[model samples]
Target: MDIRDLLLELARTYDEGKGTSSGVHAQDLLRRAGEEWRHLLPAGFDAEGNGGSGGASRTPWIGVYDPDITRDPKKGLYLAYIFAADLSTVTLTLQQGVTSLQAKLGEGEKRRRYLQSRAKQLRAGLAKDLVEGWDARPDFKCDVLRARSYEAGSVAARTYDTAAMPTEISLREDLWHMAEVLQHAAAVERNLRDEMASSGLPVTKRVEGEEEEHAGLDGFRPKDGSDYYVLIRQRKIKKSRSHEVLVRLFGEYIEERGFVPITKKMHPKDIVLRRDGVEWMVEAKTVKRGNPTKAVREALGQLYEYSHFLYEEQGKGEPFLLALFTEDIKAYAPYLEKRGIASVWKTVEGWAGSPMAVAWGMVDEQ
Candidate 1:
């Protein structure tokens, strides 16, 4: 069934009374809806729906989970579609898990307060622009305790009134948007954990919403044109160990070639090579799973920004732009070349570069 049809069906047929024909029908619709939602997701994601147990639930929902984030709704983050207790509205939300929180604080008003506070932090850590259209503070108007907790746990949401239900395309778009937000959150959490581990810092329980602590970024503050500023404001928050290593290794390679590589603390670009009045602004990114496209894209943006602000804005001639990666970004090589930016990546034999880089003597043809 179409998403709107499924939602409308559940809203109209959902019976408050237990064991009623309509109640059974609602449960079946929810199950089928879950399967349909599951088909819309990518390989690593799974969708499931809960229409209530024994009796109809006050707020039925279909949740999408990434195992890398958390399978259970008791902890970690996920995207879900929750119908109001009265079924007057359905909300698509990126929400936190609250069951574990209640387990710690016990049920009552204290738990409710903590849930909202945690939700605030979750919202704070993510870039506001990423989920721009969603409401940061949404009221689900649920009567039951569990449903109320879900409302308090919401990070961001978009509510649709049943009377003015959304089109199928709109519903799918919202679902995909929330999915991207969840993916971005998982990457941030992963980077934070990696940063902590590399520094020998104990990885604290992330389930409790304490994941924003930046132990690895101690003594580091944001500065315009610096990595810290770009990372924090642009949602590239933490630098992984591999990223650091790649930069260091590339610097050494440049030094051996009789060029001076400016440290990041002294400059905005990852590695700025200088010798004989020539400068090459090199931005390095470590590719994960051999997919260098995301890294390449980020490097491209940073490269242009740093070049404009640090050099051109000050009347300095535009520096040679180079996009460096941990793996081959060959697919983007021609694209970068068209824009007069060179491409380079790590290889088993040594460093490899695009034709422009080769002609510029950044690396020999290989």
Candidate 2:
């Protein structure tokens, strides 16, 4: 059968059963798919008693799940093709089931490093082979199972819609163009394996009943508010004159000039400065990477919320909400400015920008 016939058959499965799957229907669909494109499919189907979904109550869609490796439900992989009821659309999905298991490899700094590096690698690989109309989810529901899905993993999916019945040539071209999305998902799995091998951290076998750690940054939000502080405690920032060192430098810059600066005294903020009849709340974030993307975003949130907490203690005065980034983030300056927050970008030598940018009249008054 050609691509057109496969599409028609998928539609028939959905139309006939209306998303209610039985063992017989599942076996039949698997047989048809295996017969159609056995050469192009990935591994794990060659073994004795290859696996397929028995049946599912999949509303609005009829689907087949072919597990290449299902020995470990949390760490294997699958290729899925499900057609919607209308016969006008179908979705192809590829996912790595072990992603959540990998993300929780270690407890602290080591895990953070692994997650950050792995995120970068997966993002790069997906972008490298991504196709049109396909949207990439970098975190892809790692540990959390959404109500819509059956398992957790890295997933890249896209839908193809045919306004009318597609001709053989049209279906073939359509399949070829969309095949890259599955390849993209497969590439993500490969990148993750590379990340794991190169990490060199001591691998600990997971204990049963262990909870999975969700990768921060879905998965964009930074995990721990105390991470930068943990670096401070470990003295890892002392030997290296990195962005993290700027936290103490900038805090001293405030205090040495007669402003009283306190660390963690304010709620949800790294530092708070008080003097001259005004309070200046600051969130200090440092990154060792090229761009302080997640750090800066998290800092903005902390500083904004800290301002409110300070207001509860004090009053609704035009106090300063400041964000200090160790990297050059002039592009993000406008965003911080719009929120009336003054931003300071630190260079290896020193810093720039003053809280007076908010026009609070405190600069001259002080």
Candidate 3:
């Protein structure tokens, strides 16, 4: 049977009691489901199915494993297809291994809180729209500790009602995309580990949003600009790992062109490119599909604000303002130029930029 049929059959026949006829049937069907799911596995990945230990389980699942990250669900990141307690819906999820967190943080509420917080932080690495309809924490009727842990450790998921399951083709596509997303997360996590190592800090010792010495800037210096501090405090700046990735890439790109790029802890700007005693402040923003304008709008404001408070107001002179985007914001190039902000955005081949940005030698014309 296909995926839809398998899910429907299992959902219709699932029994909660141990060793019941329906329970046995559910176990057999789940095994077949897991076997079928193997076809959807990406290269170098493997799959496993679990119906229950001795009896039946409230949540039966098939786990897809990347050996580099984990082959066991108790220790690392993996993809899982989990059936709800009521069998009303089945969700495909990218989830962390909760036992590992428990080992590190100890069990109970402390571990639970850390699980959710870590998931939220890692979720930032993914694009907003990529997981727009998914839950960051999926609670599949946490009657058992395993079920509760699954809810606590969820990173992202797409759920489908059993009454209307998707076709096998769409299921395959979703699995592929989810796997790619998992791979991206792995790469970013490794980069962060390397960064921590280079800074001579243990990976476990770093904390997000930890207080650090503020960079010398009007917005950050309370005595220099209380108004700036008040304004900044009121504005809730959303942190994003996708934004970090873009900034790093852009910084490397500029550095390759013989410019020095600087980013410091608690820095107001994304990047500072310097050459020949001249500096350009860059604000990097990641673009979501169908929302390039929103990215441009945000970057524009940041570019202007940083230039004013970090440079112009401080008599550092107006450093050149540049807005960098993950994708082409060329549509707003003219709009930004009229306001004295140079715009440069990424393209598959190289980079694209506003005329002023090109003239300022920020990016090569594509």
Candidate 4:
């Protein structure tokens, strides 16, 4: 039998079985046969070769045997043998031996076209809705109106049909309007709070319109509208420079402890924290479950450089700490340790809770 015919037969057998053990075996055999054929063929044949028995034997082929999509209840498996004239990619039309399969393929193409046309219509309708909606609204303000004016004056609006104009113009206008409105609202709230703070009254008490809730205001507001002096005391106690979540946690643990943990303003890569009044360099690393790549190794090297800088250049006689924070500690711990690098693994607890360590490093002896 011809090599191509043999491959097709194997694919057909596999397809009839619907991916059973025999089907998988057939597939493996077909793959090996293809690989062997490619090895025998000259490399230049793929680029451009003469049309002869050797070239005919080297027809590009893929064997697929799976459950038929067209068959009622999809009984016995079917095999698909696709052949191309050249090694370069080509679409095969299976016009013979699989009439139902061909019909299904045609149906699929039609459905795809239908879906594409429907998507275009939906997009056009959405664009129209946005423009008409914004124009209809009397309260639209700021950069939105400015952008709309520009869009309305553009060449596309004048030259193209209503459906052909880009949808982005409407979207940009709506987004700009929303941004301006939100900015105004925020400004109003901030002004109100500042004014209340100056008037010796709690901002929470002066409920002029809707109450504005700012971050870190929880547990700071007093039940009774007490003197602004009382509110100020609470505010000072709760305020911290870090993220609100971090601030709240630090507030509960470190407040009144006299341990003024200075929040480093510099990048983690640049900042070096001091221990015992001496410059102590620490490298912070965060990793997920995947094996460390070359990028990770580079980052680790960068951290090492930062540590060396602190010790040699700054003359801060303190040990370095390599803090490795990871979700999966067990998987990465061994890998990191193999590199002779000491690491601290921290597991995050619930929100606003402290991170619990599966294992941590002692002060680096090196």
Number of the candidate with higher lDDT, 2 or 4:
2
> lDDT tens string, model 3, 1-366?
655677678789877774424437877776666466543344335677678776768888878766656777887688988999988988999887877655555666555655665566567766776677777777686567667777776889888898888887787667756766676555444433212345343232223343233242334444455467455645445545456656766776788888899986436667888899998888887655334787788888778776776666667788888888765665688998999888887653456789988887777865
Q: Which residue runs does candidate 3 get wrong by more than 4 Å? A: 20-23, 103-107, 191-366
TM-score against native, each model: 0.53, 0.33, 0.50, 0.24
Whole-model Cα lDDT per candidate? 0.71, 0.46, 0.70, 0.30
RMSD per candidate (Å) reads 15.9, 21.9, 15.4, 25.9
Looking at model 3, residue 10 earns an lDDT score of 77
Each candidate's number of clashing pairs is 0, 2, 0, 3
lDDT of 2 at 193: 41
Looking at model 2, residue 189 earns an lDDT score of: 46
Candidate 1 TM-score over all chains jointly: 0.53
Candidate 1: tens digits of C-alpha lDDT, residues 7-53? 88888987667542343788777777757653344323567778776
What ranges in model 4 sit over 4 Å off? 1-280, 293-296, 329-331, 335-340, 346-366
Residues 1-366, candidate 4, lDDT per residue (tens digit)? 333334344434433223323235554455455343331211101111111122122222332211111111121111122322222221111111212322332324332332233222322323342323232111112233221222221111111122233243332233223222222322232323212345343222113455344454455544432333345333533221212222233323322333233345533332344435633233433332122343246436755654554344456453443433322234444555554444443222211111211222132122
N/CA/C clash count, model 3? 0
Clashing residue pairs in candidate 4 (N, C-alpha, C atoms within 3 angstroms)? 15-65, 15-77, 15-78
Best candidate according to TM-score:
1
Q: Candidate 3: lDDT of 52?
A: 76
Ranking by lDDT: 1, 3, 2, 4
- Which structure among the candidates has the greatest lDDT? 1
lDDT of 3: 0.70
